[model samples]
Each structure stands twice: as C-alpha cells, then as structure tokens.
Target: MNTFGMWRLARKYDKFPTPEEKPYSPFNRQEPQEVFDGTQVYSWAAGTAEFAHRGAVLLRPLPEDPAPGRWLGYKDTVRGPALDWHTDLGVIRLVHCGDSKAATDVASAITSNGNKDGVVTVCALYGDMGFHGPALVAADTAHPGIEYEASWGDVAALVGQVLPWWPDLLRLPSVIREWKPDAQAAVVEVPANDNEKILCRAAANDVFDVTSRVAATDMANSIRNNQVDHTSHEIEIFCKDGYSETPNQVVAGAVPDTSHHPLPCDGDREALKAGWHKLALHTHPDAVAALEVAVGREPNLLPFGAVTEIPVRPGTISDRWTQRLTMCDPTAAHAVLAQDDKAEAFFIGPLTDMPVLRTPGDDGKQVWRFYAPLSLPAGGPELASVVLHHTLWVITSDGHVHPAPCTPTEHLWWGDGWGDRASEAAAVVDQLLDDLGATVDLHEHWNAPKGLTALFNEEHKKGAELTRAALLHARMTPPRTR
Candidate 1:
C-alpha cells in the first residue's frame, strides 16, 4: 500500500520514483486507464488515495523518526503502512463523508473500527456527487470528539481525527505557474525563439519550504478577502519582446535599466521584422553591434563575445604557450568579418569565453581556420571540434574548416576506450589542484570533500571535452575549398 501510494503521488508530479517502487505502479499495469478511472473504489481503495492526491503538494521526504502518538488508518481490506512520506503535522489518513448523515456514519465506523485508534485522518466530505465542496469537520476519534469550523465551510477534512492536520494540507505553494499575456499585465510575453532558451527561473512544480507555503496561504487569503489592494510582492521581469512596465517605454538588454541592443543592419532589420530567428545576442556592446549587422547576412554565424561568465578562472599558461594559443585574452578585440583584405580567415578564441568564427574567402565559399590549445605533460586531450545542434566541425591549427568524422560524445570519451582511463583523468585534474597549493590527490583519496573534487573535475572534464572536439574537428575534417 505504501508503495502504491508513492506511485500515485509521484505520478501527480512528473518526478521519477525509486527503482524498487517502479514495477508496482499503475503506470506499469496492462490496463492503467481502468485503474485511474474516477470511481469510488479507485479513490477510496485505500481511503488515503483521495487525500494523498489532495495533499500531494504538501508531501516531503520522510524524516528519520516520525512523531509519536499518531497512526494512519487505511480503508477496509487494504494493508501495510502509509506512504513513505510525511507532512508538517504528522502521517496522513483519510475519512470519507458523502452527506450530512454520512459524516455521522463515517465517525461511527472509524471509532468502532479497532484499527483506527490514535490515527490522524483527513476527512473528505462532499455534499453530493455533483457538489464538490465539503464542510470542514475536525475530529479526533481517540478522544471521541469533533469540532465544526464554519469559516472553511467549503474546505475538506478527515473524519473523527482531522482538525490538527487538515490546515497544513491546505497550505500549498503559491507559485504562479501560468500567466496569460495581457496588454495591462506587469510583465508581457516571455521572450523565446526557435532555439531553446531558459525563460523563467521557477519551474512549474517548484516546492517551497513549510514557512513559505504558510505565508503564501496567508497572502492568498488576504487578497481573496479584499484585505490588500495590490499583490504582496513586486517582481521584476526581463524579456526581449518590446513590451514595458511603463507605457511608451521598451527597455532591452539583460535588465530593464540597461541600454537597448544596437539597431540591426539594413538586412537584419528586415529579418527582425520577419520574425525571431535562432540567435543568441552577445553580452559585449561591440559584439552585439557586430552581430546585429551580421544576423541576416552571414550564414551559420555564431554570436561573438561572452554569453555568460566562465565558471572557472583561466589556468596559468606559460608565456610561450600563450603566444601559441589564439586569443588567450578574451578581452582582445576580435572581428567576425574583416572588411580589409589582410585579416585571418577565422578567429579561434578561448573555449571558455569566446566562440570560433569562420569567414568566406575570395571564392565566395566558407573556410575554417582552427587553433588548438597547448597540450600539457599529461597529453590529456586537444581542441578538436565545435559541436552545434549535433553537427560537428573539426577545428585545427592548419588554417582550415571541415566536418568532424565522429559524434561529440564519442570524441569526448574516446580516451575511455583504452581501458579505465578515469584514474588518468583524475591525475590530470590533481595536477591542476596542486598548482593552487592544495594537497588533494583525487587518485589517492576517493572520499575527498565533494566541493574540492568538483572544483577540479568539472573544469578539467569540460576543458578536455572541448579540446578533444576541437582537435577532432581540426585534424579529421576534409576542407571543401571553392
């Protein structure tokens, strides 16, 4: 029963259930539609299912020790413990009341039932099959008393043992999941194009802490009762769509106060009017200006400049190695397209900060120039390819562009093919940690602090992947010269 309830609640929100509980779920059943069909047997099968569905949002990870003096009574014939989850109040149970007479019947049935002693029940009373709202009746069967609360007459509660826990179940997280676009709304359209972009920080089923949920309920009640004129909180929203909080103002860039993106060129201006394309705007002001001009004119153009800050700082590279590395300083002014005849065919910059850009030659055909980052003593990996939308392009110091012969995942994990090379990867990262005076050796201490291990591992793995991809792109690709 505990396993079944886990499946039922987890199914409400699209979170994966544990491996052990997966097979027992109705989702795996041959006829799941029949099992989920809205019938009295289905909802009241274990009696806890209805309230479990009702208070599903209030579920939390089960504490090591549940509070003493409470038990959940399942429906007749159903067995085992309650769901392996808890609420702030205690374990959850359910009591069903169909009408005024059924409330007394439910109380009598619960008190008479030997298994229901000291059980914390959530009573769900419905006036009729059609009438959904039920009056709040908090009852404690062990004490053999019941209290009727008139304020929440439309609310539901458990029979004979419910009042204490019913309120906590109603305290759902007050996150706004949907907002219809309105001319007068504070925030307008969520800006997104064909390309996948993160629109909001909050997810649809984000869970809040108990305190926040209680505050949300209070705030919601206040607004519903006409206690406040406006919303309790003011939220600042950023969107690319030309809608503003104030009339006649269309603020742009990352924040509302930031200046607008540069005006698009003649060709790009028409493209903008046509519709939003798969483009990521550059963060640097000059890069944004250049991207605006190149938007519609250039084919397969990647936006120049840093889109986001690199997570890790650049490692110390020798003076001679710096010269060998192209655009080692991300702040260096690099052009996407050169009007003069004497510019390099391509610009390959730091994998962390800048993107590799290719330009068309005199033959009116595109050519790529690749530059690989210096190899360390470990010979860990080299820059090989640039992967975009599953298409891999090999980048090399050979001053040419070609299609990568392998997939990005295969390229990154190619070293793993020669037996277990994870220890080698760990050793490579340990040297990086050693540079910072840290005495950590990932190869030796398997149980090192997570943060310390992650600090070196994540950067090393990411850098290694980029290097491998770039190297593959540079070496294996066949140049298609016009």
Candidate 2:
C-alpha cells in the first residue's frame, strides 16, 4: 500500500523511489511528441518513463550553511517552449519568487551549476513567460525566465525521483554520445557573425550581467515610454537603425543634425595649434553670420573660435601640405543642375582649431602635421551613394540655401574630393575626429554602422557590441499593450 503526503527533500534532487509523499496533481505529462526520450521520468507521479510529461516538478531544497529557514521549498521545473523559442528552450528551469531580484538571484544560482558534474549550460529566457501551468515552477509574473540543460549523463535530471513503479524515460530514440574529433595539426575555427544582438537597453533585471533578453512588446513599449516620459536610469540604446535623439525629436534611421556643432576658442589660432576640440571659446558673430548663410551653428557651445583667422578662414597649401579653411562666397555654393559643375558634392565637418599644427610627441598627430584638410558638407550628390539617412535636404546656399552640414551647427559645404583631394579630406577628418574623441563614422557610408568595428575607444566599442544585443531585443521584444 502507498501513502501520499508532502515529500520534502532536505535538498534538490533528480528523482525519488515511491509515490511522492506530496501528491496534489495528476500524472498526465506526455513525453516530447517528436522523440521517445527515455532519459526523463514522470512529472507528477514517482515514476520514470520513456517520455516525461509537461508539468514535471523537481526538488531543490535549501542548504544548511545559509539556514534558508522558510525560504527553502520545492523547486519547479521549466518545460520546453509551449509555443516556440518565443517562450524558451526545452531546457531545465529553476524558478524562485522571493523579492524584486529573486528571479535574478535564482538565475545566478542555477548558472553556478552549469558545466558542473551533471549540468550542461544555463541561460535566461528570450522573454518572460506567463504562469498558467502550476505553482512552485521557476518563473516570474512578467519577468525573464531561466533555461538550463542537464548533462547527457543526467539528461533526466529534471525528472522527479525515479520510483520502482516509474516507467523508463531513459530509453530515448536519441543517443547522447561524446563528440571527439581526431587531433589535427591545425584545427580551423568558424567565425560567428558579430551583427547579432538586442537593440533595447535593459530597463529591468540583468540575468546574465551581459545581455538581458527582452520581448518585442517590451522594446516598442520602451521606445514609446522614452518618448512619453524618460526614465531616471536607463541603459543606452544601440543604433542598428541609425537612431539620433535631437532636442525636439528622436530621429531613427534619419539624417544626423549638422546645422552647427559647438565651437569655442572664438576662432583663436594661437591657442589651438595642436588639439583643442574641448577648449571653449565664443564663436564670433561675424563668423556665425558668414556660416549662417550656409549651415546652422549652435547658439551656445561657442566659448571662442579656436581657429581665429577671420570668421572665413582661408586654406593655404605649403610644402605639398594643404591647410585649407576657406570661406567661399555662399553664391558659389550651388547653381541650377547645369549652371556650373553642379557643386552638388558636399562633405561637412568641424575645422580643427589647430589645423596643420602637429604635436611633436603625439604619434596620431603626425598625419595632419603634413596635410591640412578643407572640411566640407556631408550632403550633396556623390559618386558612390553611401551613408545613413537624415532630414530633408533643401538647397541651403546660393542665397536661397543655408550652409548645412557645414553650418555653425555643421559648417557650410565646400571642398572637392575628386582625386587626391578626397584622400586629403579623409585624413583631415580623421585627425580632427581623433582629437575630438568623436566615435561614429566620419565616412558616414553606412548609416547603421556596426558598433565598435568602426570605433576606437572602449566605451564606443562596448556600445556597438550592445547594439547587436539590442537588435536581438528589438526583434524579440513585442509591442506593449497597456
């Protein structure tokens, strides 16, 4: 005769021998339909089977050292994705509902056993699954889920204790064999695509402390939430779609603002002979007026011009090196398609306060020591149509046009990149960017430039890598309902 009660384990285990002391549910779990897996046992009753049911419960009792007290209880099992990977893999799960960070803590604890004697790997879910199955299962109301797999040796580690009456769940159609390739003189490794990632920042818990899985719903909600009301603390978003947040609006996959970037030093040349993208100097009103006809410049941001050589600095070529910073007449900016050379190619950028000035000790500064670049607008017609999208491009020069991409905000359009000129322009832009610590592509060929692949610093690199993660999040996260 068998009796049923609360079969409390001193600690967590794989199975038991008889009818569970605690029996409230029924033995109804059918094994995975695809395969007759024998490794797993029953879900509710104390029995092993060629296949395990869906609601398989497992025990993970508290340890003695920490004195879990009332917190220690039966650990629930996570089933394979009910719908698809949209839920989670069919790996083992361990749910804990303790506090706000309870799920996170439990995930960490479970991860500790990964690759252990009986564990294979552990991971957080792609999204938080709803609870309609059973209690004591490891899960959150609307948080992330944890996924872990048992070693082949213990593939049935999630099955309840194997009782004498339990059917054999270990005779699976699948075989768990070790993969051992013969030693090679040189083993080749395959490369994984670096573009994969989540596009949203973690607004909540961090399961892996690396990249948190968010649902598509959460991502759209996050975008709208950021628009309606910004949060106090939120991680930065990756711009796989070329996202740029402006003062008035958030631009996604649009043109970057180039009306005017901040310029200080009041165009003071002496103080900017090396690098002073940081030194603030008021921008001269005359310079602003000259640039206004072509581009937009920030009202503030100007302490003084760092390259003070007349608001319209002229470009000069010395010893095959060009120190070009000339203020061409706004009328020369453009004409009717056939009026002139079309003057359509524009490459806008910041004029280094210390153009042509080389810091003797600075290694990166050597290139500019020889060639001074004539920065131009980034817009206008081009040979190879490459770069990200921005705003509407109206003819801003020729009396009807304003100096864009090249305004005080961005300097006005000038500079030719036909032959060596383009290469020269590239060098100038590079040095300026290096000095200013500006990350993002000066080339602007790829609107959605992959993260740090084009960046130089750690912060920028980290951000780019996170974009892959964010892309994942954006794709996976669902739209918020309420």
How close is every model to the real structure, measured as TM-score? 0.19, 0.20
**What are the candidates' C-alpha RMSDs?**
23.4, 25.8
Question: In candidate 2, what are the lDDT values of residues 184-231, reduced to their tens digit?
Answer: 112111111111112222213232122112221123233333322221
Candidate 1 segments whose C-alpha is farther than 4 A from its true place: 1-321, 325-413, 416-482
Candidate 1 per-residue lDDT over residues 1-482, each given as its tens digit: 23465556556644333322224565565533222322222223223534544322112123344343233323431211111112334433333332343333444455677633434433433322112122333333332233232212112121111121111112111111121112222222222221111111111113333322232232223223221111111112211222334221211111111122221222333333222122222223333332333333332223221111111123411121223335421211233233333334333443322333344546655433222111212223322323221122233343233222211111212122233333322332333322321222333443433332332233232323344433233223433433
lDDT of model 1 at position 206:
34
Q: Report model 1's TM-score to 2 decimal places.
A: 0.19
- Could you tell me how far off, in angstroms, the CA of residue 109 lies in candidate 2 after the best superposition? 5.7
Model 2, residue 123: displacement in angstroms? Answer: 8.9
